[model samples]
Target chain A: MTILFLILAVLAIVGASAAMAFRSAVHAILALALAFVSLAILYLSLDAQFVGFTQIIVYVGAVAILAVFAIMMTRSDSAHHHTEVFSKSWLTGLVLAGGVFTVLAWAVLGDKTQHAAADAPAPVTTVTQIGEALMQRYAFPLEIMGLLLTAALIGAVVLAMPLLSNKSGAKSVTKGDAR
Target chain B: MTPLNGYLLLAAFLFSIGLAGALTRRNAILVLAGIELMLNAANLNFIAFWRYGTHPEALTGTMFAIFSISIAAAEAAVGLGLILAVYRHFKTTDLDEIDSLKG
Candidate 1:
């Protein structure tokens, strides 16, 4: 199990770094997909079957497809498209991310987290228990999430509808004038 | 048999990579991808803690991860739609060039 975990973690880390380092946006996205796929495997190994499947279906399937569509739609053939990998503030970003990682590593590797982990009992978290808890114990948050999803979808449609309608309206006016 | 710290350290690395990408990338779509990575890293942390915490049978972490995944999907949809609008107005997806609102 440890060996499997190590391989998956290494694969995910490689994919993530590749995504950050790639110049082409398409290549970055492919690398990101690889990272997410390995992450789903990690979830499965961690005994999170439901979460693992959902990660593949929702993130890998839907979110990545949307990102690809967005990229294709906004593709620029200009010479500067390749240079979008970074900006002047990248050094600041590097420092900030590095600091955050250092703090997190120190905390996780500390004795407190180790003792906490050692105290935990064995678990048998299955999908049925999660389903029951979702409805019975955690119903409120689920309902709120449903509402949030609905609101976001409506907002997306509203945000995109105007430009679309304006184009169709222009076409209709020209056709009417011709008629 | 991997230690909890091992998973936590991995999560930290993933999150930092995501943070760097989100902070530095000029493409809005790539920024969104970075945010997804950050979210996934958080999900991994949650599952790790749930598996290794004192009350592993509580089902909180997995449930939280499921909710997070759903929220991430919604966020991606909305963010992409906004990016589409920005692209239509600006004719480019480069974040550096879309500075008309820089007041």
Candidate 2:
């Protein structure tokens, strides 16, 4: 189990880095998908069966596809689209991220409390239990989540709608009018 | 048999990488991807704590992770939609070039 954990962790990290490093937008998105898959596996290893499958279905399935479609719609498909992959302040960002990591790692690993708290036996958190919890204890939040998703869907459609202006007291050309 | 600290460390590393990408990347979509990574790292931490915590029967961590995942999905949809809208207006997705609001 430890060996499996190590492999999955390494794979997840590699995929994440590759996602950031890849110059082509499509390649980066695909790498992100790989990372999401590995994370789902890690959740499975940790006995989170429902979260793992949801990760696969929602993230790898829906989110990745949404990103790809957004990329395609934006017409940013060419590999040579950007001459530079990163911004001018790339070093600053790296340093900031490194500093954050150092602090977090120190706090996590330097304390004995974490290790002391690590010995609990893995709980068998089956999907049925999660379902019951969601339907019973979490029903209100579940309904709120549905409302949020609906709002997001409507907002996305409104935002992505083609820009059409009719304020000049004249019917503008409905299609192929260059902005 | 991985320790809790191991998971915590991995989550930290992943979150850092995501931050770096979000800060440095020029493409808006990649920036969104970075945010997704960070969100996933947080989810991993939640699951890890749930698995290793004293009262796993409470199912708080697992439930929170599930909700976080749902929120992340909604965020991605809206974010990419906004990116598409921005691209239409600017004809480019480069973060550096979309500096019209820069004073």
Cα lDDT computed for each candidate against the true fold: 0.84, 0.89
Q: Model 1, range A1-179, lDDT digits (tens) per residue?
A: 37888999999999999887788877888899999999999999877888999999998899888888888887842234446468668899999999999999887766453335444455777778888999999999999999999999999887755434567588765665366
Q: Which candidate gets the maximum DockQ versus the true structure? A: 2
TM-score of 2: 0.93
TM-score of each: 0.89, 0.93
What is every candidate's C-alpha DockQ against the true complex, given to 2 decimals? Answer: 0.70, 0.73
Choose the strongest candidate by TM-score. 2
Pairs of residues at least 3 apart in sequence or in different chains that clash in candidate 1: none
Candidate 1 scores a chain A TM-score of 0.82
lDDT string for model 2 (A22-107, tens) is 98989999999999999999998888889999999999999999999988988765486636889999999999999999999989
What is the alpha-carbon lDDT of model 1 when measured against the actual structure? Answer: 0.84
lDDT tens digits by residue: candidate 1, B1-103: 2478888899999999999999888888888889999999999999988887777678888888899999999999999999988886677787778888842
TM-score of chain B of each: 0.94, 0.95
Q: Candidate 1: misplaced stretches above 4 Å?
A: A76-84, A113-122, A164-179
